[model samples]
Target: MPELYSMQFLLFLAAVLICYYAAEKLFPRFQWVILLCASLFFYTWAGLPYVVFLLAVSAACYRASHIFAEPGVSAENKKRVMVGVLLLHFLILGLFKYTGLFRRWSGWVIPLGLSYYTFQSVSYLLDTYNGKQEAAGSFWKYLLFLSWFPQLLQGPINRFGAMAPQFFRSRKFDSRLFRKGLMRYGYGVLKKYAVANMLAATVSHIFTQVDGDISGCVVVFGILVYSFQQYTDFSGGIDMVMGVSELFGIEMSENFRQPYFAVSLADFWRRWHISLGAWMKDYVFYPLALSKPMRKWTQHLRRKFGMQWSRSLPAGAANIAVFFLVGLWHGADLHFLVWGLFNGLVIAVSDCMAPLYRKVNLPKKGAGIRLFRTLRTFIIVNIGWYFDAITDVRDSFICLRNTFTRFRASAFAGDILIYQIPYRRENYMIAAVALLIVFVVSLLQERGVDVREGLLKKPAVLRLCLYLFCALLVLMAFPFAAEAGGFMYANF
Candidate 1:
């Protein structure tokens, strides 16, 4: 299969653009036919076998949607239909996806984007059942929505209602939008090839030394670099995906913000994977938090301990439950479960301690305090990364121990040399420079600056010079691995 950044995929994207616009000009009303064909082809390019699963999921969801929309359907029947379809969906997903425990025995090739599409289909069903929107009228259009190529590998998990018009309607190509799309694609390339891949080499080298006599500074450096590697790779993939969707004038829910600047674990999650978090908020968190049992618990607490405890404790419990599922959503591994619980416990404790925080007065609104919180959250997040990036639970703790106890910063250079990590000063310089660029851009964005839009407002000569420089930097990361690697989130 072609990686997103591969030359073959680029050529494929170019051909799609040419054909898509030509189709729009000629058969405008049916331009979507070309898109549907392209999506089908792109998906099958991954593997022909994967198409069977995609078709099955699409068909099941399509049929279920119609059943749900039927007039005079009783409440009990609607619920049965929902539960039956969901059970089947979860069964299929679990068999293929949650096979980490039995991966040696299981030969299931879980379809790409199974979780994304399944969650999206569930959202559609729930929305229809709750009268959020009517069920989609056309099966082909619905299938297109589910199988749209850009987000098929990783996704923002779109809604049918928001996307129906974009999928089915006729539209003209906009040169401006296309240019912006290309620019966004360039940014993604710079992030992945230039920075993330470079960092990946060092991170891999450091983690592989966990069993060796690596020092605390080396482990700390490895985990910190891993954090940036993960963010850039995942967010860069999303950027490229969004850029491609822009060529077709389809907008998805934005997946990330500047998560590193987050002031708390809760705030970090809110910024990172914004769509999945939104999904949990709507489907899991709200439902659990507002459930009858929680309501009764709240009443009991209110009568015994008063208002503050009543409000915060239930929400904290809901947070822990939601994050437990979030961790399980990643995989069936013990490490992932522990990672989720760590986050859940932090958020739960913070929530439950809100009243005490209010009682302790300081310069809460000061810039220094804000920076402190951001750095503190960042450190906490990096600690969590040990569980996530390192697979073995014991190794994760060992790395944690080494991070604090075995403090020798001088071993960093020797470890880097011993690992033969990229073995080039120029490579390290290039990656460092690229990261500096990212930091400046992110800082501006944190202050509400639209860096891309600002660049667009510059004079033609200035914009040309900047674009050329950025493109050259990307080219320097050349001889990029052709196998479609670096997207860390694709596994999920």
Candidate 2:
């Protein structure tokens, strides 16, 4: 079963497509049933052991929300009930996802999709309490939302308001939507299995090589490659999930939007892992901003630090805290924590300098300025990527050192594959071509244009030729060895 993961995914997806269409055509009212059943089966495929826990969590939230909806429940009573529900959900999440880290003696096994579903359940509860969305009248509908197969692994984290109506609506299967969805899914597959996986393999070799034996130059190169590998792997997974959901006539929120082209760290956050950042802002940042402490702090700063300082200071501090939490959310490791804080600091410092940066004399609407800023931002992001790629802080520093220092001719005299890993002409060629393609696509996207749409609008012969070329490139570049590996973000 472990050896056949890819085969299993293909089979599951085929079964889902057939069932979805059949249900839509035959018994429109049973659409939610089909989704729920498909989702359960997807979870069960991971193993039967965790199915009980999944259902239990769903039931807990289902019942708790009903308590909130009861006609005579006092406002205080309702708040208490909702708090209890949130706590129970978090307790289960901690027990399953963080028991090992929290309790050293315990050897608990965390269940699959616990993090993803927990967030979904909590979001639904919060939405219901806030009256932004209604509680699912039926347990099955709620369960389906929690366990939707396409988003079960990693997510765009659909809100109740976003997903519930779609789940209940009857979808008339359309060929164009299916074709576009399939193309998107195929593009993601190529990005992951072909581009990111190949890069991952190379990065793994570099990281495993003896530390000091490799020149700092090689280490720097590895860090840069790892940045691309991580982004492609994560965003590629999101593309696949969104594409799969689109086949069912549901549009998942896009998780990425040409983040590398962002002019500022704040803009990058808006573009990358968009759902997560939005979630933090909606649930965490807003609440913090409106709190008594923050309000008071803002007022104090206004009087003492001047109006400009008051407006920026509170938000800057909050941004730092959010980034710190974001870092800690990735892993228990310090490196991830530092990576999160590093981004937070970037945004905070950028916010402080916004006024001065705007005043700098520069070209406003020229290709030269755009190119320079793009390059500058890319370099800053790559440097930040060191914290994420290297497990050890010292190793990251060493890579930075090697990147800056010029090496002698003797450094290139060794077994190039071990020291200078990307020594092969083919390796350089592939990296260069992959980067060129990504840059072109990003440029198109940044200009508010769709690459696919633009290409399709061309003359028939040109469009066909372009598609055929992409198909051939993907086929030729596919990393067969990594076929069994699921996307990197799937674990998250």
Candidate 3:
């Protein structure tokens, strides 16, 4: 399979674009055919067998949704079909993605985008069942929605209602939109290859350090770098995917919003992986929160304790359940489970302490308060990255122990730290400069500035120079053979 960041994928994308636009001009009515074909080719090129799985999912979902919209189907039967379709979708997802948790072989290769597309399938069925939208006009259009190539691998998790119409609508070529797409694509390239790939070298080495060989400062610094690597890679991939969609005049959901600037754990999640959060809230959290069992439980709490515990307890319990499923969705591993629970616990504790925070009466508008909140959130988030960075669940505890007990200033010195990193001093300089650039851009964005639009207004030559500099930095930071790997979340 060709890596998405590789030159080969670029060549493939170029070919697809030429064919796509030409088809749009000559056979306008069949534009969707071109898109469906391109999407299938892209998926098949990655893994031929997975294409069958993709089709099966799309077919099942389309049929189930169609059944729901049938004129004479009884409401009870429609509900049964909805529930059955959801279970079948989830069962396939679990078989492929969670076999590691259930069996000993542990060598099954999960299908790409199974989690993403399955969620999309669930949404399609539920929306049809609830009358949010009619059943798709045709299976082909529904299939195209499930298999759109750009966001297929790692997603903003496109919605059927929002995206399906865009796929079939007639669009003329627009120079401004194309230019914006190019710029977004360039920015994603810089973030992925220049910043995240470079940081991965140091972060990987530090996490692999054995017991008695690590320092407190090293652990903290390593986890900090891991946090940066994760955000850059995931957000960068989304940028590229969304940029391609923009070129086609399709606007994908925004996935990241400068999460590190967020003031609390809940706020951090809202900013990070916004689509997944939205999905869980709509499909998992809200439904569970309002379900009969949960309502009954809340009422019981109110009777046993009081209104205070009643309100917070039920919501907190629902949050724990949502995040546990969230973690399991990432992978059926103990580390991921712990990562999910850790986040849920933090959010629950914050809820319980909300009254105390209100009583403190901290100034809400001051820079000092904002800075303190940002740092507090950042620290908490970095601590959670330990579980994510370590695949062996037991190693996480040892890593945390070293982070607190083995303090050493030497970890900051050139010889000690640089020796552990796979990259050279010069590469570190490149990463540092790239990070500074991203930090400045993120700061402007946090304040509601459109950095891309600002760049569009700059002199042509200045913009060209900046683009060239970023491309060069990415080239310089390209990983060696031993360090090469795909995006972190590709496993999901």
Candidate 4:
């Protein structure tokens, strides 16, 4: 596969862009065919076998979607069909993604973006069955939506309803839109190569050490740096994806929103990975919360414990269930499950404590309280990162215990500060500066300033200089960046 940042990827993108625009000019109504062709070719880069597997998935879902539109089919039968189709595909996902449980042979490959496209396929099935949208009339077009290159890896999981209109409409290229996309893509590349890659080495080094090899202070520092590294890696990739889609006159859902500024666990989730949260809420949480068993549970709690239990407890249970799935979505690993449950329990506890919070607050709307909540939430989120960053379920707890129980500056300096990497000091400086730029940009966005639009208003000479300076910084930083295999979420 062509790496997103590689020279080959640039060449491939250039070819696609040239053809895409030419198609719009000559064959306006069918311009999307160019994109469809590009998508298939891009997926083919992963391997011919993967393409065959993808075809099977797309064909199955495309065929199943028609069952929803079948004349005189009972709703129950449609529901059964949806369940059967979903289970078979999810079972495939499990067999590949969680091979240890199923005893797959050594050296089998998981198809690229299997989990992401699967979710999109399931959403298409559900939406069609519910009469939320008409079934896709063509198999190839539906395949294009699943295989769209920008979202083929980690995705915001675009909905068919949201994507179909933007994709099918004829769109003449706009220079301004293209420039904005180019700028955002540059920003994303800079973030990945300069900031996230720089920190990734030290973060991995610290976590992979035996508990005795590192001090609690170093563990805390590693996890703290990891928080920044993860955000930049993930949101940067999404930025790149959104920017690429924008180049084709397409708009995707915003996946991140200055998640660090969030004031609560629920708020953090709302701001972070917004697409996945929305998906789970729409497809899983709402369904389970509104299900008959949950309704009965709520009524029983209402009789026993008042309205608080009736409302909060049922919703809390659904949240837990949703997050349990969310954890599994990342991987079928124990640590991921723990990470998800940790988040769910915190939210559930907060929900149950809502009345007490309402009564005890001194000044809920105060800036000081707001800042405190944001910091508190940040701390809470970092605690969960232990499970996420560590591979072993037991090691996560060991690291957490060390963090609180064994912290010391002297030991950290001796054990971790002396850690070796190529250009470690220089990489640290570059990462710091790069992170500051990202923070400022995020701050401006938070303040409702469209940074790209603001840049467009500047003289061409000034904007060109800024872009050149960014390029220079990334070139300098990336050469020395260590252990940056690729975007972090691609591991999923």
The superposed Cα distance between candidate 3 and the true structure at residue 190, in angstroms, equals: 0.7
- Specify the poorest-scoring 10-residue window by lDDT in model 2: 419-428
Give the per-residue lDDT of model 2 (tens digit) for 67-174.
778888898988987898889887877665555764355443556667778777888788778777777879988888888888877887878788888888888889
Best by TM-score: 4
Pairwise TM-score winner, candidates 3 and 4: 4
RMSD of each: 2.1, 3.0, 2.2, 1.7
* TM-score list, all predictions: 0.95, 0.90, 0.95, 0.96
Best by lDDT: 4
Candidate 3 regions with alpha-carbon error over 4 angstroms: 100-108, 411-419, 479-482
Local distance difference test scores for all models: 0.83, 0.74, 0.83, 0.86
Output the lDDT of residue 107, model 1. 53
Q: After superposition, how far is residue 186 of candidate 4 from its true place, in Å?
A: 0.8
Off by over 4 Å in 2: 1-5, 101-109, 210-214, 405-416, 419-435, 454-468, 478-484
